[model samples]
Target chain A: MSQKMTRRRLLLGGAATAAVAMVKSSFGKMVQTGIPEAAMDPTRQVGPLPGVLGTRSPFEHPQRKASLTSSQTPLQDLYGIITPSDLHFERHHAGVPAIDPNTYELTIHGMVDRPTVFSLADLKRFPAVSRICFIECSGNFRKPDKETITPQDICGLTSQSEWTGVMLSTIFREVGVDPKATWFLAEGSDAAVMTRSIPVSKGWDDAMIVYAQNGEAIRPQQGYPARLLLPGWEGNTSIKWLRRIELSDGPFMTREETSKYTEPIKDGKIRQFSFTMDARSIITYPAYPVQLQKGWVEIRGIAWSGRGKITGVEISTNAGKSWQAARLQEPVMDKAHTCFRYLWQWDGDTTEIMSRAIDETGYIQPSLKELITARGIGTGYHLNPVTAWLIKRGGEVVYRPEKWK
Target chain B: MPYWACVAGIAMISCERRVNTAPTHFGYGRPATKQEIAAKAIAIRPDGKGLPAGSGTVQHGAVIYAGKCASCHGVTGTEGPFNVLVAPDTADAVPFDRAPQRIKAIGNYWPYATTVFDYVRRAMPFNAPGSLSDNEVYSLTAYLLYANKLIDSSTVMNAKTLPGVIMPARKYYVTDNRNGGDGPYE
Candidate 1:
């Protein structure tokens, strides 16, 4: 029977008769269903109206890969340099707090001529500045040993945004910061009340008190009302949920800087306050979980440096034996993620492919072996090495794991 | 006006602003009061700048540790369902190493002893953070120090004594000098 006739029959019959008919129809031959008439006729249905806010399409799904303490951005899914504010990587000591912007106040004290408290309104009144930069966690490296991992699994803790706020220097000058003050502590308002002692030079340099990200109010996970933006530094140093700035003469030696973030180097010496994120790059295309075809393939990825702009990116389709320069997307801003692409035709051969980033300072991204030899086995933080992807003859792309030691 | 004169005038004004001792400030935020600063300032420096006036003995800390910290950190503060805070006596004196058997207890990894007090007062008890009093925080610091064998069990921890108590791992801390100049170190 037709679907329309069946619906009419169900409406006409009572519960007992309908149950008998359903059983009788199931025992008979099966029938195929076709498209509904409303779908083909546009005038029969009405579309949704304009909304106050926009949302991504239901078909498109870009999600952060989360763990117990942190979540990584979907680096492979992202297209451009600026990461969507909602999809930005998050690493919080405690969980995110629900802070009310109307009642928010950021205090600046310690070793200053005049300690000051700035409201959100007052912070907005200052000369606002916007710059595109990446905030990379010092512990962003993940050694992938499986074929199921994607680019997001390898290293997705770094994210770029067009951050907008008042320059910390402007606020420092307003608060009459003393020249004798060498360092200032940035404290968060989260449950952990995270704190880090940042150098005074950074405050006077490119540091900012960011309230807006990616043309919108900062997300709660990304520190909603306000956060400190220390360009080219470790993400932890740029404290989210920034509530206080206390200038001091020396380092705070907090738990984060001491027991947590610090790592042992060669000769059993611990390296502390290693703020700057080293240059690194990962090939997003031809990554794991995505099968490749034997044809013209455009290898694409992102390369960034905390030191300066990414000058060049070298791609080696045949492993690390030889490398050729990949074309960088135009307008590669300083300390921002720069898109890179290389055109290659695969002969369906099983080989390893990787990319190395070269920064303006002439520093080449090192291999895992070289990094381990320099820092030794105990080192865990700031593990930025060239990651490789293995391409199987059957078109399966897998992560080429290296000796973490 | 002549181009040269205009350029000279602009340069003089810039120079005057730079040299001015009392420059026009941005004057955006209100001056924070002493009370306001004290209420929000919780960070303790290595030099004991923010250490409150209080003292605690290891005897008191042991009781507090058993009740509050032992559930997460082990009973002796070393055996951990969480992070290991104590190390065995047979372990290497300098525990920072590439060897497979490296123990990063408070006695071996932490560079500053005062950090224990600051961390406990700020984010301890895990469930009720920032709930510990200055005396309790100091006691916990002393207790952990004693447990790690960094200090005597009878030693009282205070602002004056905590900063002077040097950590064994303090000598191994070196400032990061990676300038992106060359290989792996960069």
Candidate 2:
């Protein structure tokens, strides 16, 4: 790798010097005339050396936009499946806490036979497991009003990572979880001490206590020492900076579960503990900022479902009047984001394009109108609607804003 | 000692194969003490479980609110610079679809009274969270409830009295029924 980089650097240096010399000679006679010996490529040229760390090119400046409470991932700038650890979206109640892994401890008490506290090292000693999955904030939707919105602006709160940890079922078996314990409380160590009540069935199924993201230690914004990973569930329920897990016979009814994260549904009823995210998809390319061309354009996007693997993604070229299947990228895993693409030839005409996802459970993504009609206008959280992009005759792309109260 | 003998000894000590229905304890972590568990187990349930022994009056809470919470939640808890903790008088009568114009205050939205206490004690005072005493938390909870008209000024809130304060919106909270499908939403 070092040798290849050295050769490439040498070639780049030669090309750069030649280009500069060409520019210097093009208008040298008209302007300041004499090309000095030192002015024409007489400079220091050093060979590239191997480094312990790597960095993105200086030209690539993708960054996560942040507010006071939350930071959004640059979803439109990502490719393939895994989101870079630094670019992961963060939504915390208080702020990220700096914790020392050597002193980190997680307590599991309540309805267990033997209440134990596991240190960071002790957790790593257990059977190790790795899985690629996406964690999306339950409130990950934006009601766009104009064409200036990109896919990242529409939904930048979901990110996928190769999480590494032991299965929660393994720890449950070791602690001898009482069968009568219906729910458990997972709490964080931040200033807010964020807590959420989770059903025990999820723990027995596929819940994990992850300590690493991608291929390295988890980022501080993503929980640093440790966090609870509930696959296919809302991001808030997967408590970050995890420190305690207390099993109980019922939901603890914490403030987060009661006051926040709950959604208002039909018939004047508020819905609580709505965990699994529904099937959703968004077209990343040709989405707001990117203009469309008249000729062949490959429409690309990502689709994911909390229920299971994304089975299919259908694209509609002329709004929702007609639909066709988009090709799904290979190796679609369960509870993970799957990339999809479609080949299209856009004529010089104004049209609307959109994509809808169908998960393994045969559930199709709903439109914003359908969702509002069912849940009512005052609804705020857990909104997953089909996003549409409007392409004008002049190759301008814009978001099709839906009327949301 | 020969190197092969050391390798054989290491292998014999490392690999111990056993098949059992129950997972054997890896004996990794230490046993958590009763006191340690009590310190971190701060969650309060809807049934009044885990409430510390403390009491506070709405009058005491008013003072604390003006000093600590008013800057973020407004003077009367309705006119918020941040989040509105109290809604207008007619907020409850409004239908669910149109209530988005009004804030989801304790009177109009929160289902449980215990949640107020838990939220105030766990995360309040926006600037300095978890800095209030148990009595102070109870007082603030009482003040917010009183300001929202769920409770009276003379009411002294404690673990025993808090669970009995039936929030009007408690009956409106239902478990999620939206099983994903292609048909009409549940």
Candidate 3:
């Protein structure tokens, strides 16, 4: 026999006012935000009339946790790969500047045959290409020494989006970039005037001047008029609110490059220009704050690598004693987040579930213990360790926090 | 008709290797003027290529620090409402990578003195950034250097003497050597 269905007829081709009034009389106002939104019965009601802009359902609320310098995406609440534009992670030294497209201009000068200034209109006129990729902050890891934490609280700085823009190499060719120019300084228009010196080879290789994100104009939090998009690098190198490009022979050694972003490694050395984010994977479903029921369960997560495509992800249901390959979703693009899923029959035993990703370059994500043995305890940036989620017998889930000295 | 068909057939044959038809230049932007380039080129390198002509003394810097910077960075630069700016009992002698607990302040971790001026000029005071004059920036730089015990109290900081001050952490810096493979992490 077929499953039972709701008995209400589907409403169509009628004025929304009559349906809204009828629903309001029965249910009384549900939401008090002036629009009588969500004031309808769940099983049967006429939805709001079509408006100019779309809004998310009143039942769902996914938001980014913000601080003074940065904000983290709601990774646990998110599903699939592409992050919503407004919900994408943001990190600004000063603050997002309100730029008018008519007055905004990006100037490319120094070590070029022709120095030129391109307005937003000028950049849009060039050939545009779109691709999906992830931009992760170098300081993404937070070893706060606590067991109670969510994925957003642990590592929410990584976000993926489909960006549309003209390739920076196209503009480089138009300006006649000099062969001797090895480095270029990219600067922002914010109050900090953030600057970073990137290698010139990245321009010829997949760098883009992106202006649109996820099928719409880019949000001001991610750069409104334009921002630099360096695929497979740390997010800061992809400077937002891009204003200037100055080609040169050497690194500018700005305050960002020398004092702040650089991380200390083993021995007496400090690592400069560590751009690529390594392979990382975190189980989002069984993570903290989500209660589990012991039965036939499906574990799901996202895996990504800055160097190349994620080849495979291994799930360890019985802790680190053994591992099995999880099934990968189709159309796994290069340098983009790929979703993976695995099926397991939980025997109501308290155990830890974990995931580790392997990139196309055969670099496997290391454990926190293995990372500490190699890079020592002092290294801070680019911390991409395999994360584990602990499941309790009473149907409680929590993050498996690693101890760092 | 046969002649035209033969020409079309030849065109199809020529498409075997997908001949490159992309233009070398699309010419989308206008030439930038000298004035516009000068207005936005604000990055200052370690070799001191962009410092404006200004001089400041440590005496005047103390007064300016009390008025503008003391609210955020503390009056003595060591006690911080935010970031501690001064050195605490010669913390530079401790190797930061080896010692995990050492706090990174301007007195220990920064590799160049020019960065101090460059950062203050671009973003500082924590409230109203980019509001300090060049002379006031130089003065604050002098006061901070003196507070960190890197410079003498009588020294005058200008574009010339500022770059010459050697930071202790300069020699410890190295380029990133990490290459992704099955090898050990760098």
lDDT of 1 by residue, A1-405 (tens): 444333322111221221111121365743322323234342332322333454453236688989878999999999978899878999997789999999999999988888989999999998899999999999898764566778887788999999999999988888888999999999999988999989999999899999999898999999989999999899999999999999988889999999988888888788899999889999999798779999999999999999999999999999999999999998798898999999999999999999999999888998988888777777667888998999999999989877655
Docking class of 3: medium
After TM-score superposition, the amount by which residue A352's alpha carbon in candidate 1 deviates from its true location, in angstroms, is 0.9
Q: Fnat of candidate 3, please? A: 0.73
**Candidate 1: lDDT over CA atoms?**
0.85
Candidate 3 residue-wise lDDT, A323-345, digit = tens: 99999997698999899999998
**Clashes per prediction?**
0, 0, 0
Top candidate by DockQ: 3
Better of 2 and 3 by DockQ: 3
Chain A TM-scores, candidates in order: 0.89, 0.90, 0.91
Which residue runs of candidate 3 sit more than 4 Å off their true CA positions?
A1-39, A42-45, B1-20, B89-92
Q: fnat, candidate 1?
A: 0.76
